[model samples]
Target: MSEAATRTVTTPPGLLASLDPLLREWLPRQRWFAGKGRPVTGFSLVAATELLPSTATLGLYHLLVRAHQPLLPGHVGAEQPGDCYQLLIGVREALPPRLAPALIGHVTQGPLAGRTVYEALHDTRPAELLLEALRTQARIGGLRFERDPNREIRSGLVPRLVTAEQSNSSIVYGDTFILKLLRRVVPGINPDLELPLALARAGCPRVPPPTAWLVADPEVPAGAPQPVEPYVLGVLQPFVQGATDGWELALRELAKGEDFVAEARDLGRATAEVHTVLARALPTVTLGHSQLRLMVDGMTERLEAAVHAVPALRPHASGLRSAFTALDDLAAEGHTWTAQRVHGDLHLGQCLRSPAGEWSLIDFEGEPARPLAERRMPQPAVRDVAGMLRSFDYAARSADPPQPEWAERCRAAYCSGYAEAAGRDPRTDPVLLRAYETDKAVYEVLYEARHRPEWLSVPLTAVRRLAASGLT
Candidate 1:
């Protein structure tokens, strides 16, 4: 029997079929699982491979499984069919005491009965093996691991998993290289890898380039229209050792009651530097009347959806609608907007301040919830500016005590710095900036309502500010 065929010892008929019951319960509990609130009706294995052949003691497996959820009536997000997740399962007769937290559960009945299983990432041995596979540029089953020929892959790096509050899984190797393992994946190119490669080629030093990446390209029948999008399995990049996240840095400054204007100003310049490089490297387009109309429509649609999801947004609905409507009017008045590749998701959290006093932008993946195509599409650079502005506001409110004016000061300084670097003032276009800010705040409303109830006031205050302004 083939190694893959024999490795199905986990179950008599099949490995996935046997593990389905267990994963049904366990997948929902995982932080990376995107369909937490929804009920998982069923699961279907898209692909499975035995990375390491089963031995007397261990079996390592990789799986891509589709999780289905019941459709909700009248729900704006109900149309999403399902989400696919990448999993690395490690099986053994028994797990060590140290790996107790990684334990998924024990299989009672299967070809390999009474065996214990857990997330492979938590185990050091499996992490090393995964890195080796990437180093060798190995291809097993439907998963393909490849590395940039220009970068060197060192050996004997200690591997440890980072458990952060993110939508994916990550592993840091010897504090030298960090690899992000995409959990909930979508087809098409992920901006995280695509944008960084472009920036690197363009010689932008403000972001880290990928040293290696893994992709999943399953075969399809000949002449399939719009073939399945390749999932970015994982991304390996140079770790910024001793770099602190911008969010934490901001909080620290606030705690010390020190001015962050200078830091914020520098960050703006860094942002402009990336934006300039991106515009030169990627495709740029002029968004005319039709395009602006489409953008306005999308914002309006999201606003409506947010109002439904977050009841607190009801009172401010009129103002939000007015902001979106103004865009339509601008299009009618024959105004055109320029669109280019931008950091689709930008905030204090998406940046890193190196110990050398340099700022590096990280995680170009855009918003995880948006469609890959939408995230890849060119957008007004103002969108990124708006996101950063919102982050400043958030930092102020989330401090030991609320400091609203602190956010305002930093926000103005950031704008001033951006204008100096980009040679154009974002504040000049009030309508466009307002519209994007409104859209971002609307997104935050739904997010805060769903995830952090105590933080709902942050965005709600923004809503009121926009509402009180007649620019909409």
Candidate 2:
């Protein structure tokens, strides 16, 4: 880390006067910190709302912090500062020995300099306050807790922080309700909340609807040109009883050398059911010549970017580009595509198989790295199918010696089931499906190259196969 790693905060210094130094060291250690490997240039206090009055035995605070990172080379606009994050802070007179791990270091400066501070979500007492606030639909300072009127959150449910989570902090209340607190708070409507509500309204049973949600709607500065985007603080949903995520289920089956085609078929059907409901509930669009051109252009652009990011992709760039070009050819020949709201980022890990042998989808938040607006935009349902296919490929490759045949069998079965439920065969549109699959593989190539170099072969194989010929 360079000395330039210091955050050059944009907001007034007073807001974080006490916790600045502590957070500088603390934020980077968090998994949800988006600017990892980059120097935190500074911070701006977007909003700091006290959930409880200072006189309380345990003072709770909700803070919206913007962290700025130094620009990266050849990355346009990366130099711009401020990626917003949400934090729950619990202040106390003394830190308990058992809660030492949750400490954010002692606050040595600020109006409350002598107080001890830690992550509130880690402490059960403070964690329950969040639920209480939601149950009562309370507003403390700038924070607002809203609930679905038709739903009820039972009382006396013990709160436990889910430690294995990435990107956000989740608290499960006695295995009844799960609250996912958004760590990197983005300004706009979050798909995690929006999609589930729509699905629930459409009576889509494959997903559990949001029971309640929390948001921060701060007053914008006078004369600001744009409306202040409401920050999505957190969302509460019913906890799936005795559920195993699809990824785990697939892995277990792989280890057992058992056929997963049946389960895969069921998952595919559930996916199609959700898509059908989404298409009917939300706005749908038809991609004409111009729209298809834009879609192809975006895919090509991503391929070019991935090639540069991961040198291993350079060799297959031309072959991959052909897939995108084929989409244009289809449009030129009078073929049109339908676009609808989809699970923008779908994978086995994002689904759960219940004890009743039912498949339910979770996490409608799409790709977290992409802008919220893009995640919400209607796109071809095949994009989601492509994602699931890639996930199957990953599962097979991760197995001992790899099981290409098993993956192929499951893939075919899944698609067959999807066609049965969707009333349209995805294989019939090989050109569109292949393009999306190639794009997904390209994304995996870049991701695996950066995070798991050894795992590069998984997606690299798909890239070569997709670029060279048809899905085997």
Candidate 3:
């Protein structure tokens, strides 16, 4: 790692204290903030490095802070910790007209009193500074900006902040590269960077490889044993120009009432190819009786929790419980299943279609709400298959009149395509497939009931159908 000659400056004392009031009001309103509907009690600074010194006219500070919040309804006794977030805060004596919208608030006390703070990514200079650091592999204090030695990044690509409604923030660099900044971060090797690198090394072209990435060294005690791994902050990858997200493409086709079977089939093939490579690139495990029992137990636990959270799911609870226990019944017969690393949150939105009709999968971050270890765990590929299948159902149901026939055709086509590429159709394992699908629907039910009451009908419709099928 190359170190820049610029002297590193420490964060001003009491900076966080002064910003707490402003953040408590601003953080929850952000689309990327995870602690929605919960009050931010306080914050503890994990690591703070002055990217650009406070003495400068335009100062930039990189912060990793843990936001403390109240425990969930049932997790009071559990060891639940707050979420750590990555922030780029810019400080200026006065705001420019262009940066007015990015303002976080004006500090009234402490080191930065009377100065304005705003999101740094919205400013051109700060965004350029990040790219230059990555291009040069510069190590600034605890932050390490590294790039692929083989890939040459040209200097000075214009930066544009992506305004998409997502769990994270992004910045596109002159249509050549895109940087995805993870807001709610954890201390581990994030799968977003880990899996794509593995696929790239295995010669899989279905996913884009990261060209640059940011890592934060652990802030261990002076005499304590050093941590084994650093926290992954962000990833930079080649931007697929002229690409349309699968969700948008599907909606467009559905609005026209056009057949999407061909695209759905090809998407299945793409998914299978990625899965095949992942199995070869990573270690695979066979889940036997004990493992299957544990998995079924987790499913049952989640179902009970969902039922408690959303009373509407109570009627389907019996049927869903049966779907989960059916796995246990098979385990009793000496049945086993293969588990490998997979895209934990596979859905239409995670896929992209190029202008030439080529498909590419992005965002290996998995379910952001899940623990990093759990998200990285090896799972039955049918889990991903079930996610896509549910995505098709979602698209169909989201239509004006609800296109059940279209969804069925797409689902069958997708399975056929998977069988062709994988040599084993997921439909062949009816018991496992139904179990995973049931688990996904239960999750959706809770999510919709809590976040979008109007959209509750979408997943409820699936719960009704799956329950009627008896999940046998």
lDDT scores of the candidates, listed in order:
0.87, 0.87, 0.91
Query: What are the candidates' C-alpha RMSDs?
Result: 3.2, 6.0, 1.6
- Model 1: worst 10 consecutive residues (lDDT sum): 1-10
- Candidate with best lDDT: 3
- lDDT (tens digit, per residue) of candidate 2 on 376-443: 89999999999999999999988997999989998999999999999997898999999999999998
lDDT of 3 by residue, 1-472 (tens): 5445334557778989999999999898998888788899999998999988777899999999999988877675633478999999999999999999899999999999989999999999999999998998888888888888988888989999998888999999999999999999998989999999999989999998889999998578678776646889999999999999999999999999999999999999999999999999999999999999989999999999999889898888898888888889998899999999999999999999999998999999999998899999999999999999999999999999999899999999999988899999999998899899999999999999888888899888888887767744
| Candidate 2 error regions (>4 Å) | 1-13, 54-56, 75-78, 470-472
Model 1 Cα lDDT, one tens digit per residue, 329-380: 9888999888999999999999999999999998899998888889999999
By the lDDT metric, which is better: model 1 or model 2?
1
Compared with the true structure, model 3 gives a TM-score of 0.97
Q: What is the lDDT of residue 56 in candidate 2?
A: 63
Top TM-score: which candidate number?
A: 3
TM-score, candidate 1, is 0.94
Model 3 local distance difference test score: 0.91
